[model samples]
Target: MKKVLATTMATLLFGLSFPVNTFALPDNDVSANSQVLEKVSLPNGGDSSQSEAGADNKAKEDTIAKKIEGKLEAKDITVWQNDTVNWKDGVKLKEDNAEFKNYLEEASVTDLDNRNTNNSNTDTNDDRAFKGKLKITFKDKSVIEIADQKLYVTSKMTNINNSKAPKNAVDVKLQLGEGVKDSNGTIGQKDNPVEYGSYRIKPGVNILNEEHPQIKNSLFNLVKLQVSDPEKYVDPQWSSGSANKKDFVVSKDNNIFTATASKLFTMTFKFVGYDRDSRKSIEFDKLPQAIKDKLPQEQKIKEGEAFEPNKFEDTIKENSGEIKYEWKFKDWNPTKSVSVSENKNFEGIWTRSKIEENPNPEVKPGPGKEEDKKERPEKENKPKDNSKAEDKKEIPEKENKPKDNSKAEDKKEKPQEENKPKDNSRVEDNKNNKKSNNTFPRIKSNENKSSSNKVYTRTSTKETKKESKTENLSKTPKYTLTINSGEYEVLINGQVIKRQMDVKPLIKNDRLMLPLRSLAEMIGAKVEWDPQTRTAIFTNKGLVAKIQIDGNEIVLSNGKVIKMDSKPLNINGRILLPISNVANVFGLTNGNTKDGIDQNIEWDGDNKTVEINLNK
Candidate 1:
């Protein structure tokens, strides 16, 4: 049994790494194959801090680490020679593999500098949020390819490594293609099939999966790539002919792309849709001559049910004015969706929204568009440093009072400020006990809230000294809660918040946990986490209301009520709000339309004056 297993290991792994034809072991010699297996090395799998990489890449490598690191398949993880962090490709260290054993043991340490200092994007003083794109490259070869193109990706850096370079080793959860055979030779997906078999490694004969992917297929879709070399591997301009790189011309036959490389040299081949290499090949469904003619001469991509185009509307307002744009749908894929074309009518919206027109060099806090580490508020406790609430944000007229000095005098004129009931009315709320300070997080709004729906804008204050608690505050606070609306840019007073997430202080399992809804408030969103369904649903006034994690459907609300569209997507055990929709919903608009240092809002039945600045 050991001999059989050893032979299987060599036949499987060695054929993938290094040169497949360098060694010699006859087909009948079981012992020789075992020797080859003995030579196969696994990675150290230890934290990047302990790895041989330099100092900067160690710290935050884990915190910044992407989902890829979790897919490794080795016993002890270790680093590789290419300076690539270990496990990025799912390779782990083995107790054996003495040939490279020293790499893990002798690995250097990355003593990280604990200073929040960066000349590039760092402003320890002003406190800014950063959105960086990371693209992972394997020996400079593309791992997950799509859009008729061979792509390269960079995983988010884990904070484990202390080195300057973002560290966190990468991991690849390599799985067999849709129709490929597994170890037990089952011939189906999620089921192991292929009973261990022996093959000569002389021809570098790598196994092909149902998708016609070669061994350790570099084109897996486990992680999305940010940038890639499209000229060589992209699909044909259409689907029926050859791709001409000169004029960026293409054929309609683009479906799958294959890459062949040797150290410095690389080449990509395009496959047609419905080609012989498709997952359909596993079924051998007899096809008509027309269908046969449509397939390419090589491997084909797994045909999908065409892209479902959803309608979208973008509205933007500036110091200048407001503009609205509508978009139509044809067939939209990820690559094509972001890439605006001449035929696509996004320019009108882009120009009006000022995304292209008014470019801000300084990055704002909150999430970045699409994947990677989204923009988040610098969790730093700023803005709350100076000034009191009423001083900065004068209450809206309805909440405060219009030009009526009479109302301002009433709130203050009461030499008896002590007798005023902390009041059940929100400083924004219905007559209920909802503390604008408690339930409202800074995005979509709070969801843990049992059915009551209300959004309030509150300021954040840090405690330098602790005092006796009051009836207004339920308990001694661990973290302050603040809620802001995306209607216009939210402000505690007149200060613009870098983070838009609503921060809620709650007692969960006895310990306080800040939920996504509160976090959403800071960034902007009314988030609801459903324990019954293990899902999170986010809603906003006129943006896309989406269900995530377990969201099976998405609903877009132009300005109406809640609704569902397509099935929600599950990602990283957490649901992701659709980028465009979520951003739009949580985004703040200018609140005060009238004149202002602060607008006059009337409160107390139009008797009080609250200064409301629409959008600060």
Candidate 2:
């Protein structure tokens, strides 16, 4: 997915922010935030000759407009920042998901906001209208704010395995019926998406479920179920997680999506095995008469519904690699149950065959038996050998055991009470040996002294006296882990350490990227992981700020205020903060030296006045 803005954005901005949508933007046309740019849509292009006949000017306008939009939709459209344009309908065009995917993959690592473009002042073509901004990308690397609600997007495209696409791709996991929330599309009713939606993988698909704020080769379609609304769209069943309609059972568990149909003995998830985006085309139509007839009025023979009508019952053949399950209106049959060939967590590899690690190991497999066995791999019991224990017992020690005759010898060689000091020497020798044999992993020492000359221990367990003595090698006064329950960059005292916005999905050296996890452990929060969303959402009565480690929002649980660097930032899974900054707004932001970090700002304090260190 090429994230390039293709033609120079200055040119695009000139084109978009101009008085007329079709006119060229000259360099001298540059303007600031106050100018209002007019919006004149292109004429229609539906059958040029037909339009030339003057069937109607409005009709002609629609045609021409669609043609231009078609071109823009094929690729993403970026405009100057903060240039607000209130377009009715066709005046707006869509950016290609591919480019946005690539851009985000790059942005996450580059510590790019991929948000708050309204702050950029250098898009030579930025005018009042057509705000010079990047076209809205979907949910993967971008988190669209609809009504200021942080919504995710699920997107997928092809050739992932061994394919050099993206690595740290943000995967917006969705429940069986959730849709992603997106703020950048034509949702019509509101300016933002109402509820955060998610995606369901259906029956047959797999994706790079590695990291968040992801990198991707393509966000089109290979094997992925992106739950997105562009407006964070939700489905009818979103509210209803499970509904038992007589013989039809639709349920989703873990991350594996499963749809079970009784009469058909079939699951309707194979639309993707064949790469068809809609399940109604295949699964909905195949409903049996007994099943179809028994369907409720809301469930049967509907028009204008998202589901398609079936000729009969839903029959789908899905493969989980190791085992293939074929389902029809009656029941499902296992076609073949061979060992899955990829990661053991993903499959059942024979120990003899080294599990060929797939660069793009399929994370989500379609239907059948994979639902319960995805996250927790089915453990195979490896037989243990007891020969070593038996051999040791048989040898009675390889050096040979000392018999009763040696006991008398030991007594004869024993020293008297006056030799106690010599005995203490042996004890000291044992202590020395133990110290020499100590085998512990190396830990980086956090002992650098600061100007205060006060020794501070970073580990949270040093409050106990025993621990204090072990940690008192330095003179820095000890400090406690004291961060108000709000999203904030990991800091020590007033000094800045790690600046983060969204600390949700983090990783380092291939480990669970933990800021909240460690913080939670330090502060004590009953940690809970929602398998459905793959989100590490936890609750603590002591107040844990749901800080946007990647975003600028450090929402204090108690609703206190903190000045911020900018808004909030969503950087590569970790919510980044401006170390020296604070946050009070309902959103996230980042900062520049020009916009210096704010510390404990009061929005009402003379209109959000920020206190920044001027001395640098």
Candidate 3:
């Protein structure tokens, strides 16, 4: 106890001699002691202010050492050295060849410079150099910086003119070399240059004089040439008299086109009908054979020339009965031009002028025409009465003769009136039938016969009207719902839906997800949302389906629950349900091919389109 008390008293004296911070502390407490130790001198005779200056210098060096991102995109090309090579058969890149892809990786980089200053925060008084680099990347994401790396490609020209230079451009031989970049990083050096594919000067193309055909089009002017021995190799030179003597220039990476002017190309102009609502084009080849035969024979286009498609401009009328389309030329795809050096195709676009149901159809008899048919017999009787009155005037004495003679004349009229089968109402109302009506028993019999005939006519008319109504209902066109994947617009019955959808139709879990409202409205179904439950209800033709957001089961009005391929997604506040689930709930089924029936739903995988055909 005495020794412990002495030790405690000695510790207190040592703590009091030095301040509270004079005692050594754990590393975690360094921040708490930082302020108090800021001015403390180092054991090596260094001040805290000097140590902070060194820290600032180290931070600045780290800032300047950051990397800058830079990349370059270029086209790859091939040059031919053989004079016998054909230019008409233009060269195509063999993407399958591994060696051809390597050329893209071996592209040269030169004249590296860093233009970014944001990485470094050097003060105006500081004198440090920026060390950023220009990074050139390739298709494979491989990077190479500008350095002292060089790659070489060599070729030899054949058939040099020892005696004199050939006046014709076709007689000149060529060599193939690689495009190089100069020290300034500019490409297209003519010394040890790459050759353009071989071609004989076209029949009418002129390559001489200041306004040469090749120079007029800059594409052909960049061809490189060198005059050397047929079978011997010569070193490429960059002097005025050497291979660099040509005045033409090339692109950084020469992009050879698909076709050259050496071969004849065919140009055809097509006048096609474009329906904007359906997004369908009716080409000339799709027209009926009978209509095609009736129109003027299609004009044959000459090769290496452009022509107009005006032959079919006024010949095609929209009376074909297949589709109610009145077409008028709207515009052209590639406008017509006079230049005919290469293959040029022009399409004369035609669009539907108006939506017409039936401009001219067969006219059926109306109510007024039926009245006219009934009144025809009365009109005929009027002319006959006038003739009888004339006969009375010729024989005035016979006017007072017996009624029996007149009855005989009236009996002759009965046969003529009965010949008019459809004039029953007019025949019953004849003014000269008093004698027949006065006989009570005969008149009663006639009345009953006339009433029976009237009833028969009315019954036949009602039956005919009912049949016509049923036929018209059957003739109504089917409803078509067309939905293109990744498209916001939906088409119904060849007409675009006026309402726009918030989100495009998409595919998830190998099932197509369609908007609930659009899909329901397309098939004549009503959609209702229950916000409290986050559920959507679709009702159509006594069928109801209840779908909840993020739920994989669909409940139907028939008390059946269906397991769906995917859950309904709530995207952008709009519910999207799988099409297969909706289809099953709506009782849609594929048609039997053996019965020549069209399917209710069609899925086109290639075009990513879904078509639902519904019967009314």
Candidate 4:
């Protein structure tokens, strides 16, 4: 029966193309021909028709078994889901490749109960859902053992297909099973089969598990990201869901991410005014419409919670008059310029007092201009006569009068009576004396000399006393300052002022910045601050000095500008200036004391004290 079946199969397969000469040959010839045919027979069995038939059946059975086996090629199999798998043409199988059979024998499957609706299960055996342990050898020669994963083999007839997969390439889809763990205990989730092309697989077990586990939740998001080089930038995306916040998480190994955040700060302008009805101060957000209309729209400072200093001027000009506003920080007027910054509140108050009219109205020269001018010359010259009279009073009468024996005698006898009223007898005597020719000349000279002497003596005595008093005052010294470093207490002459400093003296750029008010007062310099210009003016002993905040130049009364190494600073409601520079400008000498033991501006670092002795 097997012989008949083999013959029928052959005829069906080959279409009966065999020659009939073998049957017609003699027995010896047939034996010889049979031996030759035996050499070309299939290897399943021997030359006998029965054995040949059995071999053909066995071969057919093997082919059918391979189709149902569902053995996967161990190549680029991925154990994790959501990973990209590359495909390429695979190596062809050879009969002599014994190593491939050993690899297949080692591969075992774990049955997975779940079925993917998108693709049909290649494994039809209901008893065993496919599961496997495959040893994958990577190009780096490292090996990994993957377990608890289902393996599916796909051919052209199988339902599995990928448009991106290489043509003519046999693919293996690796379906990860729940509770599937690698040798390293990496858990796997149920996912669609990861398809890999034939080129990626080897005949043996291919490890689908990656060496390093997939890191999740390792992405951070920035609300806004900025980079200097946009060409080399890469947009960051979250691992699972959309970024919900302006913050991101980074991996422990990768700790650096560059980004810039958008932020805003507020500046508040608080306008304060005195309410006449309430007799109390009021803070308002809006100015009166009348006041607002008078002000230039661009120059008008809007009363609001947020304001810009640069947009408004220190003083607003109106058609009626100019209104000056003061920025009140601690004082009614701050010495420094207004600086707007984050969350800073600036308080301002408009001047409430009416503008004063000029007390002396200007007189314009008009129809009476010529007569007024003529009177002005006479009025101007009148002071010259008074000045001459004042100068004449300084001379002593004794120096101006001619000394004569009679007068000397008279002065001695009537010293007390001389200044007293000369009675009617002296007048009659002068009249009689003027009547004599030669006697009148001498008598007239004596009378005139006595009259001039009396007037000069009275004025000279009073003027001499006034000059002596002024000389005494000029000999006395003005105020003096004695400073000790690191101590706020300073001695103004003999009086010690304690707690006068807001910020302690600081040394910046090898220069000392001290409180301007205290230093200027001690040196007899008047200090005044100009808010509009942001300048501090110091006047002492006919020398004027102007130090502007953040200005590097100091102007002097002599029209000389001194360039300084550092600008003036405002600290804690006080203007601070370079002490040495100010001292030099004010003509304060820097030298040692009389005893030569201590310097004038001495710095004791050990005690953190600065001792400054003026005029010592």
TM-score, predicted candidate 3 vs. hidden true structure: 0.26
- Least well predicted 10-residue stretch by lDDT in candidate 1: 344-353
Ranking by lDDT: 3, 4, 2, 1
Each model's total of backbone clashes = 131, 115, 0, 13
lDDT of 3 by residue, 1-616 (tens): 4344445544654544433343444456456424433454556788666777788787654431121122222221112212231221122233444544454334333224423323221212132433333344444444445332211111121122311111232333223332322223333323444443333222222222225433344323333323233122222222212243432222212222111112233555555566554457677787545334433333333232434434344434555565554555554444332223445455665565334464322234477656765775566567656675455444534565666567656645665767664644445445335534432323344244333322212123234445334333232223233354244333322333222344677789988787776667545577777766878888988888888876888899889999998888867645688876787678776432244454655565555555564541
The digit string of per-residue lDDT tens for model 4 on 1-616 reads 4345455645665668443442243345344424433232445544556665777687765542233233334332221122222221111123434654554334332222332223323322122323444444433333334445442332112223333222333333322222222233333333431111112211221122212121111111122223222222223221211142322222222222222211223444445554322224545544444443333222222122223343343433223336432222221112112222223443554433223243222244465645543453344345654564344443335455555445554534452464332332232234335353534323444244333322212123224445444333222222222234334543321223344343567778977777776566545577876767978889888889998877788999899999887677777555678877887887665543334553335555555555554533
Q: Provide the global lDDT of candidate 2 against the true structure.
A: 0.29
- Compute the lDDT for candidate 1: 0.28
| Residue ranges of candidate 2 with Cα displaced over 4 Å | 1-541, 548-551, 566-616
lDDT scores of the candidates, listed in order: 0.28, 0.29, 0.45, 0.41
Give stretches of model 1 more than 4 Å off: 1-186, 196-518, 521-572, 575-616
Give the 10-residue window scoring lowest on summed lDDT in candidate 3: 149-158
TM-score of 1: 0.15
In candidate 4, stretches whose alpha carbon ends up further than 4 angstroms from where it belongs are: 1-266, 272-307, 313-342, 349-354, 361-397, 400-616
Residue 57 in candidate 4, Cα distance off native in Å? 19
lDDT of 2 by residue, 552-585 (tens): 4445667763544454333432222332332113
Best candidate, TM-score: 3
Cα RMSD for candidates in order: 40.2, 39.7, 27.0, 22.1
Candidate 2 vs 4: which has more TM-score: 4
Q: State which candidate, 2 or 4, has the greater lDDT.
A: 4
